[model samples]
Target: MQFIEFKKEHFIHDEKTGNYSLEIPKDEIGFGDVRLQKKQDDGSLAKIDAEIIDDLKQIKIILESPQDIRVNF
Candidate 1:
Protein backbone atom coordinates (compact mmCIF):
# COMPACT_ATOMS: atom_id res chain seq x y z
CA MET A 1 0.00 0.00 0.00
CA GLN A 2 1.13 3.54 -0.71
CA PHE A 3 0.70 6.45 1.69
CA ILE A 4 1.61 10.08 1.95
CA GLU A 5 3.55 10.81 5.12
CA PHE A 6 3.15 14.34 6.28
CA LYS A 7 5.66 16.30 8.35
CA LYS A 8 5.53 16.26 12.15
CA GLU A 9 3.82 19.60 12.83
CA HIS A 10 0.39 18.63 11.57
CA PHE A 11 -0.39 16.15 14.34
CA ILE A 12 -1.67 16.94 17.81
CA HIS A 13 1.29 16.76 20.18
CA ASP A 14 -0.57 17.35 23.43
CA GLU A 15 -2.18 14.06 24.33
CA LYS A 16 -3.75 15.25 27.56
CA THR A 17 -5.65 18.15 26.05
CA GLY A 18 -5.79 16.53 22.63
CA ASN A 19 -5.30 20.00 21.32
CA TYR A 20 -3.65 20.76 18.01
CA SER A 21 -1.83 24.07 18.44
CA LEU A 22 -1.87 25.22 14.84
CA GLU A 23 -4.42 27.91 14.25
CA ILE A 24 -7.00 27.14 11.59
CA PRO A 25 -7.83 29.87 9.15
CA LYS A 26 -11.43 31.05 9.01
CA ASP A 27 -11.61 30.44 5.28
CA GLU A 28 -10.63 26.80 5.60
CA ILE A 29 -12.51 24.63 8.06
CA GLY A 30 -10.25 21.61 8.76
CA PHE A 31 -7.12 22.89 7.12
CA GLY A 32 -6.41 26.39 8.34
CA ASP A 33 -3.49 25.50 10.60
CA VAL A 34 -2.45 22.19 9.11
CA ARG A 35 1.08 22.08 7.80
CA LEU A 36 0.59 18.80 6.00
CA GLN A 37 -2.02 16.16 5.24
CA LYS A 38 -2.23 12.61 3.91
CA LYS A 39 -4.10 12.00 0.70
CA GLN A 40 -6.40 9.02 0.87
CA ASP A 41 -7.11 6.61 -1.97
CA ASP A 42 -10.60 7.99 -2.22
CA GLY A 43 -9.18 11.48 -2.64
CA SER A 44 -10.00 12.59 0.89
CA LEU A 45 -7.65 14.27 3.30
CA ALA A 46 -7.07 12.72 6.70
CA LYS A 47 -5.47 14.27 9.75
CA ILE A 48 -2.24 12.46 10.61
CA ASP A 49 -0.08 12.11 13.69
CA ALA A 50 3.60 12.91 13.77
CA GLU A 51 4.45 9.71 15.61
CA ILE A 52 3.04 7.67 12.75
CA ILE A 53 5.38 9.46 10.40
CA ASP A 54 8.37 8.76 12.64
CA ASP A 55 7.61 5.06 12.52
CA LEU A 56 7.12 5.02 8.79
CA LYS A 57 10.83 5.30 8.04
CA GLN A 58 11.09 1.53 7.93
CA ILE A 59 8.75 1.13 4.96
CA LYS A 60 8.33 4.16 2.76
CA ILE A 61 9.25 4.85 -0.82
CA ILE A 62 10.74 8.23 -1.65
CA LEU A 63 9.48 9.66 -4.87
CA GLU A 64 11.79 11.62 -7.13
CA SER A 65 9.00 13.83 -8.37
CA PRO A 66 5.40 14.73 -7.82
CA GLN A 67 2.91 12.60 -9.69
CA ASP A 68 -0.80 13.06 -9.06
CA ILE A 69 -0.31 14.87 -5.77
CA ARG A 70 -1.05 18.49 -5.07
CA VAL A 71 -1.25 20.71 -2.01
CA ASN A 72 -3.26 23.89 -2.16
CA PHE A 73 -4.68 26.54 0.15
Candidate 2:
Protein backbone atom coordinates (compact mmCIF):
# COMPACT_ATOMS: atom_id res chain seq x y z
CA MET A 1 0.00 0.00 0.00
CA GLN A 2 1.11 3.50 -0.74
CA PHE A 3 1.21 6.27 1.84
CA ILE A 4 -1.01 9.26 1.10
CA GLU A 5 -1.15 12.45 3.12
CA PHE A 6 -4.62 13.69 3.93
CA LYS A 7 -5.71 16.35 1.48
CA LYS A 8 -8.69 18.66 1.14
CA GLU A 9 -10.07 16.43 -1.58
CA HIS A 10 -10.01 13.40 0.69
CA PHE A 11 -13.17 12.18 2.44
CA ILE A 12 -13.03 10.46 5.84
CA HIS A 13 -15.63 8.26 7.48
CA ASP A 14 -15.87 5.73 10.30
CA GLU A 15 -18.11 3.50 8.29
CA LYS A 16 -18.14 2.43 4.65
CA THR A 17 -21.74 3.67 4.12
CA GLY A 18 -20.49 7.24 4.49
CA ASN A 19 -23.56 8.39 6.38
CA TYR A 20 -21.15 10.84 7.96
CA SER A 21 -18.61 12.63 5.81
CA LEU A 22 -15.76 14.90 6.84
CA GLU A 23 -13.84 17.25 4.59
CA ILE A 24 -10.16 17.93 5.24
CA PRO A 25 -8.32 21.05 4.20
CA LYS A 26 -5.56 20.89 1.61
CA ASP A 27 -3.15 22.88 3.74
CA GLU A 28 -3.71 20.77 6.86
CA ILE A 29 -1.92 17.59 7.78
CA GLY A 30 -3.19 14.88 10.15
CA PHE A 31 -1.65 15.41 13.56
CA GLY A 32 -2.24 15.39 17.33
CA ASP A 33 -5.80 16.62 17.15
CA VAL A 34 -7.96 17.66 14.25
CA ARG A 35 -11.50 18.95 13.86
CA LEU A 36 -13.46 17.63 10.91
CA GLN A 37 -16.53 18.84 9.09
CA LYS A 38 -19.58 16.65 8.84
CA LYS A 39 -21.87 16.75 5.80
CA GLN A 40 -25.35 17.71 6.87
CA ASP A 41 -28.81 17.34 5.41
CA ASP A 42 -28.99 21.03 4.45
CA GLY A 43 -25.77 20.57 2.49
CA SER A 44 -23.83 22.47 5.09
CA LEU A 45 -20.97 21.22 7.22
CA ALA A 46 -20.69 20.72 10.98
CA LYS A 47 -17.67 20.39 13.22
CA ILE A 48 -16.85 16.92 14.51
CA ASP A 49 -13.91 14.95 15.77
CA ALA A 50 -12.08 13.11 13.00
CA GLU A 51 -11.50 9.41 13.25
CA ILE A 52 -8.14 8.03 12.18
CA ILE A 53 -8.27 4.93 10.09
CA ASP A 54 -6.16 1.97 11.12
CA ASP A 55 -4.95 1.32 7.62
CA LEU A 56 -3.59 4.81 7.26
CA LYS A 57 -0.25 5.73 8.74
CA GLN A 58 -0.24 7.88 11.84
CA ILE A 59 1.40 11.19 11.04
CA LYS A 60 3.85 12.55 13.56
CA ILE A 61 3.61 16.20 14.48
CA ILE A 62 6.88 18.06 14.86
CA LEU A 63 6.74 21.42 16.58
CA GLU A 64 9.10 23.98 15.16
CA SER A 65 8.29 27.44 16.33
CA PRO A 66 7.26 29.88 13.57
CA GLN A 67 7.19 27.17 10.95
CA ASP A 68 4.49 25.11 9.32
CA ILE A 69 3.56 21.89 11.13
CA ARG A 70 5.66 19.07 9.71
CA VAL A 71 4.22 15.60 9.14
CA ASN A 72 6.38 12.55 8.53
CA PHE A 73 5.12 10.41 5.67
lDDT of each: 0.34, 0.33
Writing each residue's lDDT as its tens digit, candidate 1 over 8-35 gives 3443345565543332233332222223
Worst 10 residues of 1 by lDDT: 52-61
lDDT, residue 40, model 2: 52
Clashes of each: 1, 0
TM-score top scorer: 2
TM-score of 1: 0.24
Cα lDDT tens digits for candidate 2, 1-73: 1123333333333354534333333344434444334445575555434333422444322111111111222
| Pairs with backbone N, CA or C atoms under 3 Å apart (clashes), candidate 1 | 25-32
